[model samples]
Target: MFAKVIVDISHESIDKCFTYRVPTDFSLSVGDPVLIPFGRGKKKGYVIGIEELADFPEEKIKDILSPLEKEFSVEKQLLDLAIWMAEEYGTTLNQCLKTVLPVKKKTKNRTKPGKIQYGNPYPAPKLNAEQEEVLFAMQEYFQEEKVPSALLFGVTGSGKTELYLRLIEDCLSKGKEVIYLIPEISLSHQSRMRVEGRFPGQVAV
Candidate 1:
């Protein structure tokens, strides 16, 4: 595998990644800091990506020397989240990384959250024929291990939340956790109330 490393350089090149071949038997992750051959000397770089093929010629590509700053080894998911934030907020990667992980400080270990408990969920109300059809199709998707994305389009007060509550109950019954994100803060109160009304203590917000 080859790693795409963003070398620590400032002149004529910023936010550019250099491709380097990964050594066999070395476990390289997305956010690992490593030493690599750059120019006529070695330099420290962050591993941003890993791929099967090398971007440069096979002979020209250099192997990553070793991992650096083991204490600061970032999580793959954290790095991925930083990348997403960078793209989402139109900011630099460095800025996003700093926001997520402050330098020189070890973050406390967090316990994994348990599966959400949708206690005695409220039964879904009777639905119109159209709504029933939509609910049936969506439920069928969950029969398989992989579920596809679904879009629900309707006018306001068209029982969209009812459909959602039904699905949430179904998922929780099958030991699946759900994460519902509210894009706007203003919408939080209403959405949270609705979800809490249906599932009780299952909601964090």
Candidate 2:
């Protein structure tokens, strides 16, 4: 038996689906991670399909080495989405997957002691009638199945950050992840400090 594996070469190069002969005792499945040799070096890829090709010469094909992952890292729907993205963006499926998946990192797990303390524990200023109405509207909008993109149009000292903090707190209470994007590096550092002070180990910059 032979399997067709899609291998990601490089960002600048296109991915190629190569057919490799599977050993009789080999146990392989679609989406199983496998290591295979390319032009000069070995690379990681995934098995997409399996079939017996009669036209190809048997001696030219290579055999798949041991698999990297025991199971598929992606689900079927997400895999289809990645394939569509690869075609639409003129990029390889591997690159599309890399962009969608979060970067895995090995970090020490440190549990924080007791209650977290915030340096700026100032109470949020009272919202005006207009602000209160806007907030209520936003709450309703977010309650829909999909969240629509929103723009906070306000000048300086408009209490935008305070509202953001309240939303973050609500999300945290529900066990959700929050990502904060800031334009300035200094502002990001300050925001990180404030979030860390409020949520301790739960908040990651």
Candidate 3:
């Protein structure tokens, strides 16, 4: 079996899990502390997952040297929450570990996050039942995973843009921010015009 381990490193450059081949006689489980060879020396890491196959070539993956002491083991509940946040926020497990820990700072931020809203420059489009169904599926995913994701597959001019606008409306209702990415710089102007037409002064390229 192969294991996915999040090494105890603070550097953002190497902020990801490293897959290691489990020893034949080793006993390991998720959340167990393990010692793995990192660079020229060994580092302690927490096992987050295990699978039957390696993510890449089998020969390149390193072997987990040995299991660490029990004192270094992590709680399963905390580990699960950390894994979920890592997937949702595009973050590494090591960073999430620090995030999940209780902050000793006496004052907490009570201020709410700002959200962009639709401007009056353009009227919103009405979506058909099929389009609404796609939105519903994505919102359903949010309950299980904090991040909601859905694949919108259809031919051109199928009201896909309308669906995106609806999603932006939903996000704004919940006071959440959205990052809309465009591939080519040349298309950026056209994309911005479409979005700003609806959002007006609420958008920045």
Candidate 4:
């Protein structure tokens, strides 16, 4: 098998992709982030595509070093979203990809790392009448085939976070992932901790 890798090099001249050989025993998927031998060093890249045949000679192609075991695979929807972002924002594809992909972190030692600290699950209180009505209305809106983006507005101290947690739980129950974005840096840490305590292992941050 052959894999067409989009190397992470930022040079305009080297922006185009290259093909690499895939070992027979190796299993790979599109959007899997991998390390590939590029010149004298290894560079991270993504398997944008895969093929059984290579345009170049078989001997010229290098094998992938390995997949980034700790990194999440890029979803096809995310790739499409990246392309759309590049065109919409007038940015390079690499820039867009970099924003969505995880950065490699260096560990100082080879010793086994400590496990992530997980907080106990948040104890959710029973919803009051108003909250229940709002939840049901939002759920009904989402049940439609062509649901539009939603905007929820409430004053400070409103049970917005509770509502969000409820919706997140519902989505998780259906095997769906959620992306929660916060505009303020000050709130990022607090929100992450709260969500972490609520969802525990289910959160990535």
| Best by the lDDT measure | 4
Q: What lDDT score goes with residue 58 in model 4?
A: 87
Of models 1 and 4, which has the larger TM-score?
Answer: 4
For residues 1-205, write the lDDT of model 4, one tens digit per residue. Answer: 8998777866656656789988777789988889899989999888878998899788888898888877768788777676687779876666667776655565352334643233546678888898899989898888888988988788897788889988898889989888777889899777876887789867754
Number of the candidate with higher TM-score, 1 or 2: 2
Off by over 4 Å in 3: 87-92, 98-205
- lDDT against the true structure, each candidate: 0.75, 0.69, 0.76, 0.79
Best by TM-score: 4
List residue ranges in candidate 4 displaced over 4 A.
8-16, 55-60, 65-118
**lDDT (Cα, tens digit) per residue for candidate 3, span 1-205:** 9999989886778878799999999999888889999999999888988899988999999999999864346567778777898889888778777655433344333434542323325567777888889878866666474564567788988887777877787777788656576778897766665687687755633
Local lDDT at 129 for model 1: 98
TM-score preference between candidates 2 and 4, better one = 4
Q: What RMSD, rounded to one decimal, does every model reach?
A: 8.9, 6.3, 12.8, 5.4
Q: Which ten residues in a row have the lowest lDDT in candidate 4?
A: 109-118
Tell me how many residue pairs clash in candidate 3: 0
| Candidate 2 vs 4: which has more lDDT | 4
Question: Model 2 has how many clashing residue pairs?
Answer: 0
Q: Residue by residue across 100-133, what tens digits does model 2's lDDT show?
A: 4444566554556753344334345688876777
